[model samples]
Target: MLLQSPTQTVMSLEAPNPLSLHIIHLLMLIKPATSGGRFRVLRTAVSFFYMDPTLMSLRSLQLPSVNTGFGGSADTRTKDLPALQSALLQLTQAGILTDEDSNGNGLNIMPVTCVRAAMLIRCNTLLRGHSGVCLELVQALLLLLRKGMTPIVPLRGSISASGDLIPLSYLAGMLEGNPDIRVRTSTSFVLSADKALELAGSEPITLGPKEDLGLVNGTAPSATLGCLAVHEANKILLLAQGLVAMSCEALLGKAENYHPFISSVCPRPGQVECSATILHFLEGSSLVQSLKEEDKFKPVELNSASDNPIIDIKSGEVYSGANFISSSVANGMEKSRLALQMVGKLLFSLSSELINPTLNRGLPPNVVADDPSLSFTTKLIDISMAAYLSELGYLANPVTPHVQSAEMHNQSINSLALISGRYTLQAADVVAQMCVAHLFAVCQALDLRVIHMTYLKALRTKLVSKVLPFLNGFDDQVAEGIYERLHETIVKSWNASACFDLQERCKIPSKETIPVLRDHLEEHEMHFVSTRPLQRDLENLAYPTFTQTRSEFFVKPPTKQFLGRASLGLYCFVREELGVHFHQGLVEHPGRKTSGKVNGRKKRTIGSWVSIIFTALTNDQVWGHLVEALGSRTCQVRLV
Candidate 1:
């Protein structure tokens, strides 16, 4: 019995459309037992339910006759009941065996029947949600996931798939009054199917013989989960592409790495699309000449019949086939799991390049927040990523290849689609964690790169004015020839050492990088006008311009003009929109809030910022904005 009255039940069942889009017609068939009325018509609209009794009955059908052709009475068809008795049975999902499973679709039927029941203390128990609800829904509920505003339903959304599609058309099926599904020895879940309809002030929800073939007997459960995995994979793929572009900029890569012709030579659709997308993100980037990957998943439709001996009403024929086998979903999920591991491997390589000083170009070792010796900020994450990568690689092994027969071998060659789908979701999660770590390293390295370039620009300006003019005074009449050679040498040498010469380790300058720049100048070979003095002066000027005590440029991050257009947008969004400022190394470790105080907020760690971006991606807050931010930047070719 409902603790709340009918009106309260009605109000609770009315889920507001979050996006404010109209829900057109959702047709429901409700049949009454022990009456001439074959079935009742129930139409659920945007916010209310209305019922209209349709003028149809089982008595009108000519069983074993010429017209309807729903033959019966020849051999006690439909659970030993006469043809008409089977059609009019009140227990909607039973009284006639539709497939191998005589009573239910083998799902935990409580959630399906009790989807909108607004369970009010049945047997001193209430509807139980997953323990992780708070972790998952807190952000959406606090911000975007209003009553009717959700287009993405949580795992529980499958319960309402039959009558409502909420945001996605992925899972589509329904159930009627089935009391047998509610009968169980255990008290877990436990709800009557008719309880929800009782709230609508209508008769019990039950389906007649024709509508009771199968809804849940097929591949919907595993297929729906697979669809969700596919959706998440797309988000991960796109974010990975953006991360690749940002990493390339930080590493000062040649943009030519993702050129169209390189991808076109191979021309696999996935590889081609990925390469083109990276090229688009690296547009206008000076780095692989520059560098640098949404959602469309089509598996089995959840509404399709998955039952054997399907009755075709229009043709009046019963076809027994194996439509219930879920091989498509099984193999699809298996391959998706492997794909996730592959993406994780790519992230592993990129992240290692960012943190390792030798591979990260001029960035500090470990890409630390401050002094390389004192700070090991990214070392933990780097180690964690190795663990994550290993787990992901292990998960990539095929789940379908190890199928086992079940049900006394009557059900041989099992699909194991559900198990495969579950593993795919697990793989997606690992890759997502890997992506987060990589992004953190990329953002830090990008900042250091920008600052490195900015200081070089300032130091170069002082050198050209002071040193170049002084060199021209060496033999004034022939000065132009000498000046041209010296000037060429200065420009080339300055540009070459500009990034490499300014290591964060040599903050005092000249101890490490200056000597290296002197040798690097030997390659430019400006011997016509000596450059050793020129190199020394440039080294001396680098200190006051970037030291902790006396530096004009150290206080401010480098001007944004040094960033490529694609990378600049991503960098600004991370800093400005997410409110995750650059890490100040050891200084940020000790937070502002008192540790024991419950009311005050503690300082967020570097991991916290990465998690924030991870949350945005998981909740789908970034994709729509990303499409707008990166409009048509992808390479396009006319398909033949």
Candidate 2:
């Protein structure tokens, strides 16, 4: 007995099967059309109730000889009934759903990237509502995102002219519950076709007449990858601008190049926008000079758009165009790469000035505060920066020019947008590393200058605030006294002992003295006095520590890990040891509230903090240690 209510109904059949239950549920879910007459109502009802697996085979055998727009030779093949059933059956029998055979050239793409691409395509189609895809197909796509199902899809082999046929077939195959297709579960485990369907609580959807063609007939995958690349490149541009401002500050470069008037003269929108952004970041910065300097600034710009054949629902017209061409995106990424390269060169030049005594105002050669002979890391830093610049140069090559023709004369032209996007990501990561190196050098130079130049105390305070919580109370009088004692001792030893004359004297004698000198000077050589142990007061008084050689100071060579740890140590040392309030920002500014939350606290994006940190780390002496750690291999800056 079947029970029927005003708004709900229970089905009672001879045998209550899953297919019948699904059909009844779907029927209840379908709403009545307001304007479509009997034919429209009938069509809507048929679309909902006809999605039974049992009916699929029988329906395929009885497909009416109807000629649809789909260009297959047989009318049956072009019809929705047989086409959907045949496509599903073909996927179930075949292990892989790629375009090529055994000898065909194809590339395997990441399962996640493929799934994301399919999701984007499905969303676009649904938003337009012109594709003849049934409600069942839409539900399946929604289910895919809700359950986070990722299916393996091929990268290469799609000529992209007949849409993304080869790659999209895998997407269709996964929805059809083909056991051969692999799916990635939310837990990051790879599951067989059946298991994935079961876990998702989704049934295999029966593709309508033109659904399979609709799924495969678009340039969704390439567009998705290109879009993602564009997004990442945009972020890189933001970070790169910040780095440029920091480099300018570290190098004591003039800010007039980034002035509004300079950009107004040329009137290039991209250049004007970049100039404004850089100038905004440099606002209130004492390090940047206001004088009009030579033109040395380059701006970053990015452009992104979708390239897919769109359908008009009102006109019922399918407009096929070469919108899938990604040449514009590829060119934009190349331009971004070039902009990053320019920033790298700026960092390199600033680093050169920081390490060279002649260039860095009056700082020690190589910015080595402790021992010049022991830790000459200037060459190492230069080589690393140069290597990173070289890689950026190589990545800046235009990918649009590399397009090739393939796929049986049908796919006469292609776009390598995905490849270009991947390269752009790699370039951005390398730029981050280069910025980190430049920051370390800048911080070191500032620290050395602060000891002697009182005029730079305010700048030093701002730079130190990022890494250190409070500035350590460095006594100039005490430091000067120590410098005089060390000078007198060195002179006396040179006159009294013959061997002392052969030993090279310390460069730039100041209140700062090497820790080894406090004990006793023996014939121009430092000797530890066994009479008393090293005191904490004496150690704290030493403004900067100096060593004779790399081996004397560092027990082990610095690695990337060592550099990271060392940079972190500087941050910790300032907060814990100095007992000063450490503001991560170079200048004290009010925090701006952001939508993001971290650990239940409202997050804020601090631009000044970013600039301060970049400047401090690049200008800091810690890079000397990183340089020594890298040794001769510093020139090998390969992207991982």
Candidate 3:
């Protein structure tokens, strides 16, 4: 059950779930006196927290300490304690801590959502022998999380060689009621941690012996942040597949590109899943009738016990291990960050293709719905995309290789996992912006391509009809043959204008039986149908240019009609639900050109539309559609 708060009581918490049953079972079987007691308690508390926060008593969780002389300075009872506190310095190093005393009370803060998750791994080492002294810390942390107590701490600090000490200490300081350690409440009220805790309905925790160290003495900070980064990356990974399918439709790319046979020969699990997902999302695509790892990723990172001086309750013994090192997590986060950059590069490539009229197949220049000469649609977007990509590339630089020795060489070759996790999250946001930009361009391109096809059809009919008048007076003998020749000539010219190489190559039998397959196979039956008369008849003929008659054909496109089943849903959601209408040039602008308000609200820009979609992306509203399109609904694909 979820604990609403420490004093909120069990009656107010949510009902028990399966995970809660597991915790209950563990509590029954695992004695608090055994070597596995710490594991049991950690799993119980975390699982219970996940079930639904409930007001569970820490009294039942407290265990008798048999080995208090082994862990952190808490075991020494203030006898020659080492000065390892560096909250101020760590914040200063990150430029977020500016207080002379090093308290970053009023500075920018990162809301660490994964702190609760990290506590699952953090409390593992804490409960070994010092459970009673700091059992309330876990309770206090849960309160902070429920109340949305965001620690006003910088993202830097913590080599993570001996857990995420520097960062976790800030967290610990917040719980211990450090008056200078700041936190922002759920209501955006920034104040001291002690005050925030009071607002959260908890009091400052008093540190005893190793209890303070216990609060920060694990890889909780690094692993917690890593979990957040990895989870978000995984979500984006799925979202990317759906978007790539939309891009393919906009570009009229071949469906065989994502064919299972292609991935079967070179099977990598992640690649296979991605291909399958993209292919599935392309289902029922009218456009696609032509078109189309994470395993053990959690091995040592988020789940590892990063505590120092392990306590064995049953054996009454303590052993030291390098479990506090978080290199594995650090490495994954760095690679994940690098992967985000690669994703941004792909988005750049796709956006460039969509905007370049010459490269975007039959779509108009820049996918501009208005005069291509005047409307620079998506140009600034392209530049912004590049800026985001460059930033992503910079963030993707490996933080592991630049590790500086910390704690006077005691943490030499430290794992900068926290830094890596932070950058990974940053890269994810950059890639997300790239996705937003690409989605906007792709939607515009889709509408333009659909209209372009119709316009071409209408223009060819109109243009070919011009030569009709010349041959109209002729008898049925030559007129039929002459008009047929004119049709073929005009078709070739228009096709060549869109894509030059398609002029000669034979197209398969589509709805039109294509050009080549219309009269059986052109290759097999070579009937030389040339027309010097038809060309001469149209020599001085004046047909409407795309600029002249473009207005008639540029009506709002029925996007769902041409899209595949997956893309159709996305298009409908974007247009209807999100209200991010098609990017229609100047009318979309806010200037006096189209009056102030289109319909009462302020005039919308492309950025406004994109921002709406981006907000939905962050809120996972679009992800819900993606899962529905995939034909199955789970929470999400958890990477770790």
Candidate 4:
């Protein structure tokens, strides 16, 4: 006879959210038995016990209804009372009851000792559905969470089309309150799946075949990482633009190239808009105004277009096409580097002028160096460092082609959208670091006495103390060594995630930083026309003093309709080739004409063909390459 608790026995089944608790137990039971894997069953059970119950138990578990009367009995299928009784009887036989007590008060005869083992069996089941090996899945899940923020594993890493099995498994283990796992600890949290349902009284996350596909098919993780990098680079670009403009102002650089007329002449949206914005930033500066007599700065701007991919949500189709390619961003980045290079060279000029006793504007040579022996050497070294950094920035321009030719056919190509963004970011990052280095040198030359007037004096003082301590004028060797050390610090800070942080700190209110420059050219100073002016009109047209020219001649307009073959072929072959060789002076000329008679009059008949004819061109390599690229095609043509 089963014995009751010697003292007292009470059966109390009521619990808060009883439905949820029941679902938890039910899931725990069926999950292991149905998944049919020893490892999976155990892992799932472990996770269930450890995971937050609220996140797990709120969803109702539905079990299929089946008849167990050992016959095709309609009545048995209707009720199946005997099956229910038999199950309860088995539970009693297993010592889950105290013989129902003398007064019919149900209670356990003895406390259960192996509860952990029972719970673990279920955790294993849920873990099994993820991958074949439950133990490894559990281990990987734990490791993933420990990796810190954004533990959501990039779903692209999984080869499973069944679902986001890897991430789903981790999420399951997390929700189930698995003891073997750890979550980010916080004082307050609102989030769970199951308990969340009961609180709002809603259904669980439903899954259908299409729904499953939607859940796991996209490469959001890869895209997110790429986009985040792009976002960050864009921010740095913004700041760099500001810094470049500031440098331009301080050095008395021209702002006319950014005017509307200059930018509109090219008709590139990014080029025009950016130039206008930058010019606006430099408005009303004293230093720029004073330098008007010296021809120190000239207006400069670049046009850029960004290409990315877009998903058509309304059509429910993924149209993989180039939206914005960063060729423009690259061009702009390169031009910005050029602009900065010019600025650095000018800074050196200004610094040298300050040091020469005859040219010094009441300031000592090398700014702070009082001794004649050290001043020039020290100043020159610092100037060279800045120039070197600027050169590095200019050289950092990514040379990757926007479209690559297919090995089998020149007509096919793939858009390196992510690659483009990545390169742009890398280039921008390097350029920004260079700017920081240049800024550091400039602040140092201004010296300690200028601190009260300049807001960056504090940063300059700290950087000097930490990296380069001032002394007597420096010779070339000492100067190069100092610059090298400074560059190293910039690199170290960047790799350590400190440079971005420090830059954020330096961007304070403008009122605190001393005004160093001005903006003379406004955006309205630019304009655009469809056709370039006639040779004679080019001289007559009123344009900015810093006007530059770009010319393009096309024999025919390209078809606007989306021809996949043409898209693949033209882009891979001509589009890219044209961008490179167009400015190199290659002329796309119509083919030769034949003398013939038409009607009663003598007429010249054109072959109606096209070919690339380079002026004064000696290279047959390009022609050979084009022939190989085009294969044996003889119909409609493109020549670059």
Question: After superposition, which runs of candidate 2 have C-alpha atoms over 4 Å from their true positions?
Answer: 1-108, 111-118, 154-160, 290-311, 317-322, 325-331, 356-358, 364-369, 376-381, 444-640
lDDT at position 45, candidate 1: 26
TM-score of 3: 0.75
Q: Model 2, range 1-640, lDDT digits (tens) per residue?
A: 0111111111122223322211222111111111111100111211111122244344444322122322232343443455644553364233343543211223445436435544544433433343445555656665665566767665555444444456666677778887767776666676666678888888886665445655655555555544444443444444455556655654466778788888788986667766766665555555568644302111111111122233444444444455545554456556666766776676677677677656554455665544455445345666777898889889888776776765444456666655665677567667766765655555454444333233223222322332121112335564444445554543333222211111232221211223324432433343334312222322222222222222222332221121122232332333223321222121122343433433233333333333444444433433343333223432221111
Model 1 spans with C-alpha error above 4 angstroms: 1-203, 207-213, 286-303, 464-540, 548-560, 591-602, 633-640
Task: Give the whole-model CA lDDT for all candidates, comma-separated.
Answer: 0.47, 0.46, 0.59, 0.29
| lDDT for each residue of candidate 1 in 196-315, tens digit (9 for 90 to 100) | 223323343232232222222344455555555665676687778888888888888876788888878898777778777776777766444532322234333333444433444333
Relative to the unseen true structure, what is the C-alpha lDDT of residue 606 in candidate 1, on a scale of 0 to 100? Answer: 68
C-alpha positional error of residue 453 in candidate 4 after TM-score superposition, expressed in Å: 14
lDDT of 3 at 259: 86
Cα error, residue 184 of model 4, in Å, equals 4.5
Best by lDDT: 3
What's the alpha carbon RMSD for model 3? 9.4
Best by TM-score: 3
Q: Decide which is better by TM-score, 1 or 4.
A: 1
Model 3, span 431-531: residue lDDT tens: 98898888888888887777656655554565446544444445676556644554555544443344222212112101121232223224334343443
lDDT of 3 at 71: 26
Could you tell me every candidate's TM-score relative to the true structure? 0.64, 0.55, 0.75, 0.30
